[model samples]
Target: MSRTPYTSATSQSAKMRKDESFLGRLGGTLGRKKKSKEVSELHEEGKKAINAPMLPPGTDIHPEDTLLEENAERIMLDPTSRENPKFKDMLKVLIDWINSELEEDRIIVKDLEEDCYDGQVLQKLFEKLSGRKLNVAEVTQSEIGQKQKLQTVLEAVNELLRPHGWSIEWSVDSIHSKNLVAIVYLLVALAMHFQAPTRLPEHVSVQVVLVKKREGILQTALVTKELTSTTEMMMGRLERDAFDTLLDHAPDKLNVVKTSLITFVNKHLNKLNLEVTELESQFADGVYLILLMGLLEDYFVPLYSFFLTPESFEQKVHNVAFAFELMQDAGLKKPKARPEGSL
Candidate 1:
């Protein structure tokens, strides 16, 4: 084949085209880099907008949902098994955080369905607010993230323990978690206290009540001692009124609840004349303590039948009659048959 004469101009034009192609590739790469940088800047601006001044704490957070709403939603959205290692690790860390802060030992997320558990948003917010890609290690143990969580937990725990003269010293590694066995042990501890002897005070003016807080958190208070639950429970107007009446009666030493409690006992026991009015008339606290102690035996015997047997109301009262010393059952008094209800 006869070849056409190749010109220097053609050679130069081809070379120029090759150079242009190289320059075009370089410009494309630069354009992509510029786009990525712009995206990052916009993301930062979005974060700043989100972090703008907001409602104060205890401000009614969005229609009463958990703090962990998004994390859980993400998990549910992820199509990963609950047993997935990454998901489990997430859960494990979260559970540790929650059980530690709440002072409970529930091992699974299902257990928290009843309470305020909104960690997902808070967690994702951390990544967004930080503008950092968090790896598993960072997500679980990032000092900044954990510190934020710790501050929140400290505030809640301090709030929980304030009335009880208890406080949690905040730290990354806190002792809020209880091994499953330890949880069982606490119940045993409570049992031991009941079975153990008591240095029954001459009288006691203590009370405990279960209550639900404004944030759907449940707690208990010393009802007779503090009457703090009216606000803490965030009770409705009428409920507060009723609580006011109930609380009003308790601290005034005219405990109608216990008075009616005595009447209920007398009716059931078929014992002669177990009078509550007599106890109320004198406003005797020591006798009231003994009476309530008697009532506890009836209340508890259903569960602790092995230790406390069902007995007549009179008999129950007699059971708690003697002083129980920690070292030994001291001053064991005989059951006195009261023709009249002195206590």
Candidate 2:
């Protein structure tokens, strides 16, 4: 009877190791899944808090008009400098004014509709830059003229940027998820342009396409105020016209931005390799836009604090802004909020 004593150190050890590995992997997978689910749940909560466009059948015309100024306060309280020195400060001012008064955008959404406005602007600017004729929607002010679209879907994009205002939107499509996807398409095109500058290179240029963008002050403040349209005021012309009128007389808060922008640009031009003569509007659109994008970046913090909004939109805005900011000749992150005592 040959009975060999079983070795506890060999087979048993291997089985124990296998179980550990499997459990470890299982824990890791479960951990990642939980994090992702938590993030998604938080995102949906934020959207539910402040999310929109044309009135849907179940649309709440007046679903809690109370928006917190916490976002503004947070930025204002922080004396520390962001990317640009005045970035956070200016954002505080813009958010402050937007909440304090509500003339054009009575129903101010804390979400990221400003991206739609920017997309429209970018579409027009690209056409001009590419030496193509401005599209009908880009050139015409009259909504009636805009009625005739670009013939076919293949002819041009026919996007319905809802949560869009009745106002003639001329903003940077910096942050909204819908606009972020749109901006990604635009960035691919922009990258193509930059990789070649004038034309695509025959060989690899080794250009880096950085996904993260550095945001400034104004882009954060570029909130969309979808004017509640009624049967009596359904005319697009009238709606846009009213918006234009609102712009004619700048609120004291916005006026400060114009002044500050000039001073900031004038001082920073030499560093930018742009001479005083080259600082005019037409030539300096690149610089101005980069700076404006920064403003929005700055404004985003305060804006997010208001609704517990997700940082995804702000990150995308920063990504695109960084892309634009780097384009003078040629020349852009967020944290989640937790309770005071939370670990």
Q: TM-score winner among the candidates?
A: 1
lDDT (10s digit) by residue, model 2, range 1-343: 5334466567788999999999999999999999999999997665545432211223222212222233221111111122323333333333332332232334342322242232343344344334455444545344333333223111333232222222222212122223222332333233222221111112111111112112211111111222123322322322233324546775655555556656665565444454433333322223334444434444322333122221453343333333343333232211111111011
Computed on alpha carbons, the lDDT of every model, listed in order, comes to: 0.35, 0.33
Residue 318 in candidate 2 has what lDDT? 39
Using all chains and alpha carbons, the TM-scores for the candidates as numbered come to: 0.25, 0.19
All models, RMSD in angstroms: 19.8, 27.3
Please list all clashing residue pairs in model 1, or write none if there are none: 66-118, 67-118, 67-119, 68-117, 68-118, 68-119, 71-120
Q: What is the lDDT of residue 14 in candidate 1?
A: 97
Q: Which stretches of candidate 1 lie over 4 Å from their true place?
A: 1-16, 25-29, 32-343
